[model samples]
Target: MNFNEVISNARDSLTVKRVYGDPYEKDGLTVIPAASVRGGAGGGSGHDEKGQEGGGGGFGVNARPAGAYVIKDGDVSWRPALDVNRLIAATGLAVIVYLISRPRMARARAKSSESPSES
Candidate 1:
């Protein structure tokens, strides 16, 4: 298949219906869960000096719960979903950043403290 066709297929698979999911009813209330979808696709073909052909392609898709649409008694409301896994990952990244920067920040502080000042 061509690159465009592959990209189109990826998009088709991540349609609104696939992301938001089907609505279901429970206790006279309808809930439609929603999700955030992300995807990328790329392909390339090249020829070498020896007249050899090379081709490569890559694609990725990620879907995560965003929220849900709740309808009850003719009223509608939105309820958001939280991903603890993402939260933990973010926290870990923050700690790593702080650890990497702490020494630099300390050195800057020390340098400022040692600088001469006029009374």
Candidate 2:
């Protein structure tokens, strides 16, 4: 499967819950799988009206609401989003490329080393 599919599958396997944001306020929090954060699958945009027109050849009022998602505390406590497995895979690929190119680099070094030095 592709990267997206892998992330989607991981998201599907997680648990979620809905809880109150603050005991005093009526706002609610929907706690989603932590994996959802990595996949961009949890939050979405909201509507606003302040962004409409441009003034005198200037840029228009570009306003957009930020997406929100709830993260709970645990071994899965929310941190900055990243895919650890993907990072490892990328590092491995880089190592492989470096290994594959090593022979050419070595050949060039040998050629340079073997050249007679100018007196």
Candidate 3:
């Protein structure tokens, strides 16, 4: 397909529908699944010394579950998606932060003990 067709196809496919799915109703609850979608398109055209023209384009997309909207009893609530990878990364970062600050905290504690006691 040509660049215009590719772009048009991409635009149609990459939209709110991709992010939000049809509402599911069961057990008196309505759940609308949502996702995070990101995409980009690039194209370029150039001419060689032989004056031949060539053009190319491509689209890339990344999607992940972001959250869902839950509706029940005329009330709505947002339920955020739990990404295991992100959770693990955050836990690792917290551990690293605590480990790095452990030394400083110990030094401060030592200095406070050395200083005269407050009245």
Candidate 4:
């Protein structure tokens, strides 16, 4: 397809409707699901020395759950998406940092308490 088609398709996929789903409502509660969107398009054209020409273009779109808006009793609030895997990784990293530092701290304490040799 041509670059124009690629760009047009990209625009359709990157619209707000794609990022924000239809609001769900029940019992006076409305939840609007939202997402993070990213897109890109690129094209290039070149001609060979033998008078042959070629061109190529492509587009990409990415969307992920960002969060949601909640409305109830005439009050609105936001609930953020939680990535459990990321949380676990961060916690593991912090624990590793603490464990790695504890040994050095103990050694430093021991060295400081030692009496220095004469001269």
TM-score of each: 0.67, 0.34, 0.80, 0.81
Instruction: Give the 10-residue window scoring lowest on summed lDDT in candidate 2.
Output: 55-64
Prediction 2 TM-score vs. true: 0.34
Query: Each prediction's Cα lDDT score?
Result: 0.88, 0.46, 0.92, 0.90
Model 3 lDDT per residue over 31-119, tens place: 99999999988777788999999988988899999999999999999999999999999999999999999999999998878847652
Residue runs of model 3 more than 4 Å from their true location after superposition: 104-119
Candidate 1 lDDT by residue in tens digits, 1-119: 66777778887877788678899999999999999998888888789999998776767888889999999999999999989999999999999999999999999998888847632
The root-mean-square deviation over C-alpha atoms between each candidate and the true structure, in angstroms, is: 4.6, 15.9, 3.3, 2.5
Best by TM-score: 4
lDDT of 2 by residue, 57-93 (tens): 1111222222234543322233344557778999999
State how far residue 46 of model 4 sits from its true place (Å): 1.1
Residue ranges of candidate 1 with Cα displaced over 4 Å: 89-119
The better candidate by TM-score, 1 or 3, is: 3
Superpose all Cα atoms of candidate 4 onto the true structure and report the RMSD in Å to 1 decimal. Answer: 2.5
Model 4 TM-score is: 0.81
Candidate order by lDDT, highest to lowest? 3, 4, 1, 2
Clashing pairs in 1: none
